[model samples]
Target: MKNRTAVIDLGTNTFNLIIAEKNEGALNELVHLEEGVKLGEGGINKGNIQEAAFLRGMQMMKHFSGLLKKYEVSNYKAIATSAIRNAKNGPDFIKQVKVQTGIVIESINGQKEAEYIYGGVKSSGALSDKTSLILDIGGGSVECILCNHSELFWKESFEIGAARLMDIFHKEDPIPSEKITELNRYLEEKLEPLFEQCKIFKPHNLIGSAGAFDTFVEMIETEKGNDVDLRELKTYLFDSIAFAEITDWLCTSSHEQRINRKSIIPLRVDMIVTASILTGFIIEKLGVKEIGMSAYSMKEGILSKLIR
Candidate 1:
């Protein structure tokens, strides 16, 4: 097995990279990089990747390329999901990435993405043998997987995500009740089939990974206090305070405000609401009260493949 491997997740909203090494059956994180590309910010609405957004992504890749060279990374894999999958020029974009940075970004479908999330969760040692539902919300899509004893019973991905939802239904500041209603209706319609599929699985617990769950942990550790466990995050009530605080903070803040705020930026903050909403709904709809957060996901999957 390769001792060092790098995994890059070219996400719709953020491009993330992790350089790690595996030895003695343990994987250790060595390097991490992320940038807000907002690749899917308006692509879902326009059905094409705009020049500005495409250029932003290119610049981010170029920067990442420099970092990879600096670290002398030899075995690395980069994959893009959702946004690139939906883009009309996604093929051209991937070709351009290879030409520009020498990093080939493979476009993966939703089911495959869910499989990677499942791989990451199973490695976390937090999952139980009983039925568990894994929900991973990205910038362009959400994936839900039901598993027991590390085996997947069902999996589904939805087009709803942080940046996509924010662009589609989140026009009003602090998000008006009417907008929330419309969003819920849309989610219900889309999630109903998956919910029905989940009914057969009857998951004993729900596990959340990536995006909003990451922000929730950041908020709790930074705002609530230190010594807070991931379980405390599951106790979140999604009250008006959390909604208003997060929404108001995301809507009114600019780059300068986030520079010194000592919190995860507003871009990540923007997705937290949608993440929380989905989380809140999953708990109520599935009747599972406990949700565990695993910070690892597609990156780990990539590493697993490379190391093996």
Candidate 2:
């Protein structure tokens, strides 16, 4: 049998597993699984993991562990991001997972998370020699990595992610302007200190590394034209007008409406509003003309490390 590796990424919103093996010098997937855990649903401000959230996470872990055993994938690594990093009872949750699922989840820091994200982008064979800025907005945090000419330069992680922001400001359905204002204030507070430090990076090229970013790119491209090929290539280049239009449409859309209109599932619909705002702000602040998308992330990072 061919050797295989499994990488599990436990995020605040979902637990994802990528099982693959090297073939012809490339990673080929054998199985991929994603379970919506929403581990950070209500676990941030109070700095605690709620019982319901904990159970959801545990159930997902149990399901993943079963998949691993059934697939007989012995080589594996599991890492938890923002959710675990923030919760006061995070350790307890990790311990419980290990005991219940036989999977030890590593609560990785932002720097390591950035490294994995970089690996994922690099492996995709699309990164060029430009000031590429990679933004990964997860359930509990946002990670920013800057690279010049495919060389790593600087990186930062903010405690601002889709789910976290949703819990923070988008509490009401069809969020109001006042809430948006409050959200911006919160983001500004966190971003202000990083401005001076971010100056050195000089990143003009924009690349977003997450489902939210990818989804936005797809949405804009589809709306502009029914051309799938054209959409895939240039979806990242969301202009100011297009960004505003999409944001306005999504804000007024009920979760069900967004889900049905574009096949956006219920799990993701909740974060659509916050994600749009975040993506728009990132593009505006960086003055980026285009934003790139990559399917690679922490899961790719874990596998790369294991292979090395």
Candidate 3:
């Protein structure tokens, strides 16, 4: 019989559940599920998980627990990131989850989160002999990693995630130009160390792992009238020119307009603009010539470890 495993990533904005079986030293995926609970909805920047967010998280976990049991996963790991790690009631929430759903939750720090993201991206065949930068933008944190195919050169997780940025800078439906400038300036200050490292490593390839990049790729594919199968795609080359155009459209569109778009999901409609701005900023600052998107990220990273 195959050994079944379930890995749950309780992210700030979305909770993801990935179930797989170990077979011949490899992982065969059984199920992949995502729930947008918005765990950081009203309290991420304030360093607390709000009451509504807490209830939403608990409900999601209960649902995920049911799925895990249905799959009969022999081994399971539930890991929480950013919002939970920084929240004041995070520990209490974990205790409650264990008591209520019989699922132990482990809250990992930003550095470990970055490592897992790197592992996931590496498994997707994104790494190469030449240096490359891996960027994973989550709801509460953005992980940046510099590496080649073999080893990691540098990695860091910034608190400036899309949800956090949205909360701070997206007061207007269509964010004002002045607000964007402020946001960029804030990012430049926080990412000074990353920029310095970029100068030293000179990594020209920027690989985006999961989250907003997935939506970006979908949007791009739709615009081109292409019938690209996203599941079969391990890596996608992101056209910078097209990315710039998308960013402009996102910044000018209202909430209603964004919701009407097929490419933009309901969960990401509000925060996608901030994500786009951040993506464009990094491309310009790093002088990145090539950009690729990796569908695999933290959950896959966990699976890789278990199978190995």
Candidate 4:
């Protein structure tokens, strides 16, 4: 039997599992699964994972452990980011996972998380000599990396994620324009480091890693009636004009309208509006010439290291 490895990403909003077998020095993907645990649901922004979210995360981890056993995985790594890392009960949760499931969960810092995400996107071969700004928006935090094809220039992780933003600024169902303005101001304040870095490095293109970008691509494809295979796509070029249109709709649409859309997943319905706003804010702030999406993210980044 070949070596099979499993990688579990315990994200703030979703827990993702990827099983792959090493074949002739490369990783051949065998399984991919995602469970929306919403670990940041109740009070993650307040530095705590609420009781319900904690229980949900535990259940999801147990389920992922079962999948790892079913695949007879020889090596496995589980990582917790953002919500778990920032929460006061984070270490307790990690201990419970190890004691109950015998799976040790590593809680990584934002800077390290950005590094792994960069590794994943770099593996996609979408990058070039020109500096590209890579963005991975998770539930509790957003990882930003500036890099060319060869080396990393600068990287930072912001805690102003969709979940945090939703909790703070999304009191209204369809967020009020004033609230949007406030959110923009908040982003500008929090993202000053990124802005300063952008001034120096001057990354030309925005490369969005998984999560929200996936939904954006799906929504755009549904609207255009295009059948692009996302799994096979190394990188997707997103039209900035079309993205602006989508963001506008998301910001102005009600809960009923958003949830009814086939392209919006149930788990993402509440948070996508904030996500769209954040993406739009970044694009405008950076003055990016183009946008691209990479389906690969943290899991792939881990797999690349493991296989090597």
Q: 1-308, model 1: which lDDT tens digit per residue?
A: 34567888988888998887776887676787767888876675566788888999999889888878877777888898988988898888899989998998889999999988888767656477898888898888899988965588898888887678878776655667687778778888989977898778888777767567666556645776654444223323333355446544644554445455555666775565566666676677777756667766777766776788
Positional deviation of 87 in candidate 2, in angstroms?
A: 1.3
Off by over 4 Å in 1: 1-3, 23-26, 227-264
TM-scores for every predicted model:
0.86, 0.90, 0.97, 0.97
lDDT of each: 0.74, 0.76, 0.90, 0.90
- Which tens-of-lDDT digit does each residue in 122-227 have in candidate 2? 7655467877888888878888888854588878888888887888888787788898888777777887645554577667667777567656665776776654
lDDT of 3 by residue, 1-308 (tens): 23798899999999999999877865678988888999999998999999999999999999999988888888888999999999999999999999999999999999999999989999899889999989899999999999987999999999999999999999998899999999999999989989999999999699999899888898889899876655579779888789778878998889999999888889999999999889889889998889999988998898788767
Off by over 4 Å in 4: none
The root-mean-square deviation over C-alpha atoms between each candidate and the true structure, in angstroms, is 4.2, 2.8, 1.3, 1.2
Model 2, total clashes? 0
- Residue 5 displacement in candidate 4 (angstroms): 1.0
Assess candidate 2 and give its lDDT. Answer: 0.76
State how far residue 138 of model 3 sits from its true place (Å).
Answer: 0.9
Please give the distance, in angstroms, between residue 283's alpha carbon in candidate 1 and its true position after superposition. 1.7
Number of clashes recorded per candidate: 0, 0, 0, 0
TM-score of 4: 0.97
Summing lDDT over every window of 10 consecutive residues in candidate 4, give the lowest-scoring window.
225-234
